[model samples]
Target: MDFDHIAEKKQEQKATVWLNLWSNRSPELLSMQLAKKHRPGETVSACLWKSGAFNICYRVRYKDGPDVILRFAALGRAILRREKVQNEVPEVFGSGICWAGPYIVMSFLEGMPLSQLLKDPSREGRPVLNPQISNRSLKRAYREMAMLILELSKHEFNSIGALEENKRGIFIARRPLTFNMNELMVSANLPEKQRDSVSSEEDCRKKFTARCLFLNITKELCAEHSQGPFRLYCDDFRPSNVLIDLSTSRVSGVIDWEFTYAAPAEFTYVAPWWLLLQSPEDWESDLNQFLIRYFPRLRTFLEVLCNYENKLIEQQLLSESQRLSPRMEHSMETGLFWVCLAARYSSMFDEIYWTFIDSQYYGTFTSLDDRIQLLDQEQQHEMNELVKLKTDQSTEGKESFTDHYPIDKLLEL
Candidate 1:
């Protein structure tokens, strides 16, 4: 896929943050002009908005027709077009882009975000209506969430890349796999000498090629046993992106369609981050307390997810396609999803890799000096490089906090 577009390119600052700040500090006159250009003969009834960390939103209503919401990506638009066909997301009203910022207008869909719906609404910015989500109320909500994922994962494409359209049609794998591999290589925590060697673009490109080959091989290992074909998926398939109807406890619509891609079935098969309504990296200071509650819920979630997959298989939904493989299945089992994410998000590499992920590939060993004696010479060579990386990390500093890896049998080969 278009590797150039993958988020590894270096920039001066957080472009999204800059854009957001600029939009806030600057006048809205230009934004209004943009809206006017897109929808001629319509009055700008209101400029309602909720500014997010990266994007700034505005609710613009037309006097004669339905209202639409305008959203801007401070970093700039990633993919060029709006995929209007995906019903789970808001309808794309139109877009108005300029040097200042990039913006798109979408039809205003009702219903509160699932996050607000599930939690206490008495708090500020909670959904106006609170749906009962006690231990009893969670099943319907969870099942609907699971079902949405199952249905959405059905749209498949031949290649592995970001979703984009061409003369042919709306294709999931149409875009090039454009993530910054250079950044990943830099994340290895190498000795200063080894790090200096990779200063040139050629070196980075070589590492990029190697990384891609590694990922391809890993993906194939999972693909051999998968039941479904590779398909388009939202990278951020969390609760915050989902809207739910309070009365029925059903998913009203799943928004945040940007950055969706046709990835390996293995990627989608992995458990989502929102399963516990918290992220591994940012759960809280009281991590142990959180996981005590989270693990049981996670087990039930996996049970429901797997059960749904089985039902799909029984009904022959996966007749021609592949199913979730053991490798992808181990995502939750090993928390390897975090590792997978680290490929592109290199900054998190040392923490995730050394803390937990390294054991999966290297087999059980005491330290960098310890040997498993199981891998072949070439595999051992790779392990040595990894060991050096780990050693460098240790030399730099120890992990600030410690906890057991959350799941079972993750350290085993």
Candidate 2:
């Protein structure tokens, strides 16, 4: 079986394990957990709200008050709480570990996901823009989104890492947690740092090497400000996480800050890759076709973003020195947007690099071997072992799949 197929199956199995475990115990245990915050016999009902790759959300309703969202983290014990961006972000009510897992209780923003307004999920493959949505509505949506990004970029940290809270206070201590890092860890089945496993560490190193090398090159070539004053960036900040008021075409709230962290300022300079509701590397259509559909929307978004940038500057809410529009514009023009995208998404890195980034930066390569010399000897050996390990894992996964669901059982189904 293909490595991607096996990796995907492994992910599905993990999610199933989590869901089954949660379902079996959550009704009783979850009620007990929520009981701490609310009054007894308040008549609360909870139902699954949204399930992503690494977390699950439930909408908890009460007979007397407004609804709140309960999110269970499948990977880490972290939560996002920023008073500065409180208007746009969720306000955490409480968080703790229970029998099920680590969960966060927060205010539920009212409105549908922006993705619902922009595209039809009923479509089979890559989602296209909704024909019913007017250009004016899209522009209005972009304007609101522009303001949110600008506001988020206002907060800065000295170190590039995730914001975590301890007894002392909040600090940037942990390695920056991105969605790709979590996904890679899952796919590789890497264990906790306490576990003594050389292969696991090798797999982790393989993932980081690409990012480290890319950043070093980018710092020298494009992002001179990559070293300091890192800004908050949400890996999951897309239409799916953005809530919108349909009637007014306004952004109601931004949810899913779990994958956010203090990242290099260059990351915040790229125009959002979600403008088309489909990622460039994952687009099913030809590259030209995707770009044709993409550029127009990109232009619309940038125009609205520029207008917001000017408004914020004029109001003294933003300064000319802190203006993000020009940097973002330059990123797109210089192909730095694609570079940043490739560097960030591990699964999409190969496709994005070969298609748009590699040749432009490093010239054409006949094969990966041709470029392997760019890395140190130690890294080159590690990469070879990682590939062998991946191949073995794929084989083992295929055998395990067959053992669990044999050919006869599959035929019977």
Candidate 3:
């Protein structure tokens, strides 16, 4: 259930024309139901629009009434969760929870797309942020975004999971998340010859042991934070997810509430990836140049967050180390965000765990792989011994277990 496979499989199953609303081929039953919910007495006109991979959005217009957006579950309902605050999200008019998945029609909010506002056009179509976003009216957008993070942090949960509800009550999900990592390797459509290239059962166990130890700190940190006081967090919390009212520099809408979860509050304690508007490693511009451009806006965001941190401290919800007054002032200092990144996106175990975590600890590298220049004989010998010892100790393991992780250490974050 790694994030990539979920999307990949959905893409694979896109043979039905009606499944793709953006093709302007609307499904009749869906169109009628959506029209009935929001436009009871008029002819329905469903105009298709492209949206996230999980949904097919239709602008359901009436001959004589206001239009609404219909979000059909073109992929699956893995991302859907009932909202805690209805006003913070688009208003739902109709919903379907069926065997196929689910769909919802909701009131459409009008505003400029924040992506068009924040992004500078670049070659290859990837968004490079505009130079001026560091200042002027756009700074207000980042500040408001910082404030939104604080607003979301106001919620507290007893555990980490997707938030869900039923007639019984609201609860933390006992089921695995859509980003569950164990299923990633299992689901990959690797060639059989490549699969057969795996060394042996012992080698596989040893590699797993070494990787677990290498990732021990991150896994433990995640476990510790999962205990309580989790706040609402969206994995895709970039500016593109927002809609802005530029005249007043206010956030008019926070759309796409998918992937929202009650996650660790420490996920908010660090400076966010949103300021850069892209992952550091994959920025459209030169990484250094992107930072040079992104730093001022990042500073603005952290400063506003610091003000909220003080407020949280006064309210007894935050402590000194958790405050961001001074630490996040350099490139290497973004280790906390990388730690949070590593913990949350297990699909990125190699990229985050090996590279970002290592970079955070050992500083940047000329190359991140042992592919060309293999490890020295002495280093290889020591690593092999370490993995063998760890493998023996882990022989009685329950898959993905972390019962021994201490919860109190999370406060030190």
Best by TM-score: 2
Model 3 C-alpha lDDT versus the unseen true structure? 0.54
lDDT of 2 by residue, 1-413 (tens): 00244444555665566567667875544743574464333646778776664456777777776677776664221122121122123577776556555566777788888777778556765456775678998887777778888888998888887776669976786676676665554443333221112234444344445454565568776546756788889887877778887777677888877677888788898878888887554675456567777788888888998888888889888888787778877877777887888778665664565577666766776655555557788776777776665545434524454222222221221
The local distance difference test score of each candidate is 0.52, 0.64, 0.54
After superposition on all C-alphas, the RMSD of every candidate to the true structure, in Å, is 10.6, 7.4, 10.1
RMSD of candidate 2 to true structure, Å: 7.4
Q: Tens-digit lDDT track for model 3 on 340-387?
A: 655654445445555456544444545434321234565556656754
lDDT of 1 by residue, 273-339 (tens): 5655544445544544655766666666666667777787898876424444343457756655755
For candidate 3, what is the TM-score? 0.66
Of models 1 and 2, which has the larger TM-score? 2
The list of candidate 3 runs beyond 4 A from truth reads: 1-25, 37-44, 63-66, 76-90, 97-101, 122-126, 132-134, 165-170, 173-210, 219-226, 279-281, 284-296, 307-334, 359-413
TM-score of 1: 0.65
Q: Rank the candidates by TM-score, best first.
A: 2, 3, 1
> Is 1 or 3 the stronger prediction by lDDT?
3
Which 10-residue span in candidate 3 carries the lowest summed lDDT?
Answer: 404-413
Q: CA shift at 155, candidate 2, in angstroms?
A: 1.3
